[model samples]
Target: MDASTFFILVLIGSAAACLLGSLTGLGGGAVLTPLLVLVLGVDLRYAIGASLIAVIATSSGATATFAREGFTNIRVGVVLEVATVAGALLGAYIAGLVDKSTIAIVFSIALFWSAWATLRGAPPVVPTGESDALATRLRLASSHPTHGGSQPYGVVRVPSGLALMFGAGVLSALAGIGSGVIKVLAMDRVMRLPFKVSTTTSNFMIGVTAAASVGVYLHRGQIEPRICAPVVLGGLVGSMVGARLLPRLRTRWLRVIFAIVVIGAGVEMCRKAIVGGF
Candidate 1:
């Protein structure tokens, strides 16, 4: 397509991603990546680079609201950032030596894995939950304001959570995705944090986690200025609006539909990978 049309697409797409991120705490990665490559005819490598930049922009835009409203736990985010970012750097470095198709195939599998995990519908809440000694000592857990009474949640397997975060970072950097899906899964399942806390905390850490990848993408000349400028600007604005509208739209149906979208996108990506479209 023409330059103007491509720029317009990036703006609109990024705005949508911001909305998704604001509403469900994810955006620009799963949805935008394929669209850029398939519809816009951009190279997958370039699409991934730009999408990773968009993830950083999206998270940076949302961090303030999440923190101000007490939705994000800063200490936990900071602690996890160390592992994730380090992993991202290593993944980015490794990817440079690998074929883009290989990276694409791996990315697609990761997406499917995340979608299936999310589809399990957040397993039953733990009863009489207990935290491991490390979780208790670090105070890495807290209670959130639920519909009825504010219920408390605890985290366990602190070391496991960090290990997963490291793995998530590697995947994200390799794929130019936000890696929030894996991050949340680690905290919610292994760490045993509540859904809200795990999601918000994952959101809190994404920007920091992406920094390592962002630098690598830039240095590798994968990011196009024409794409990044409009997408970033538009995403920043869209995320602000999404954050404001999220509370009002918190309904069961909305969440269910969102999950379906994730699953569909995830499966499509996996199909492409298997077919050697990577």
Candidate 2:
């Protein structure tokens, strides 16, 4: 394909990826990563680098709406970020030697968990375990809007939340996708935040988490400017369209579709991991 044609196809694909990602909360990385890898013949390592740019765009673009509406718990997001960022750095370093297939295997497990968490229910209201010193000082606990309406919410295992953030960072950095699902799972299931709060707050942190490692990816020669340019540009346009169309769609079916996609990725990862080659 000529340069112009490749660029155009990438643009179309990225826009669709962003749109799908925004609608489902999977982030564009999950969608775009596979496309760049399986379809466009991009390397998984660099595919991840390009996808990180899109994940950043996805989080930044979507979080504003949630924050402006007074739904996001910025304090919680910021606190959790400390752990996630730390984890991301470590994950990135570890990824340099590990095969991409292995990362995908871990990601597959994370993906299954994310879908289950979303389908099951929201986080609990009561504070379960003791809060960390920093969590107490930060006052990260609060309420969130629900499908029914506004309701009280709380962050359960403050330290565990931090730990989960770290784990998410590791997975995302390794797999080249924003590990928002895992992050939310840590906060919601482990820390026991409400579903809406967990989802929104996780969204708030994704960009920062991805951004933490973007420079590393760039410096390590993982990011190709030609490929990244189209992925980033396409993802942004797709996200705008998805956000606009979100409210009109039947989300239950969409959730199922999203889960299916994740499963597909997992299967691909499993295949590669088991075979030791893609």
TM-score of each model, paired residue for residue: 0.87, 0.88
lDDT digits (tens) for residues 1-278 of candidate 1: 78898888889988886677556644557667776776777788888887887787778777766676665667678888899999999998988999866877777676666555544556676622677899889887677776787777777888998999999999999988887888988888788787778888898788777778888888989888998887788778777777678777854555467667766666666677668775
Flag clash pairs in model 2.
14-234, 15-234, 15-238, 19-238, 156-191
Q: State the weakest 10-residue window (summed lDDT) of model 2.
A: 121-130
lDDT of 2: 0.77
Note the Cα lDDT for every prediction shown.
0.77, 0.77
| RMSD, every candidate, angstroms | 2.6, 2.8
The alpha-carbon deviation from the true structure for residue 200 of candidate 1, after best TM-score superposition, in angstroms, is: 0.8
- Candidate 2 structure quality by residue, lDDT tens digits, 114-191: 667545544555534455556667777676655687666555567877887898898888777788878877776777
Question: Per-residue error at 199 for model 2, in Å?
Answer: 1.3
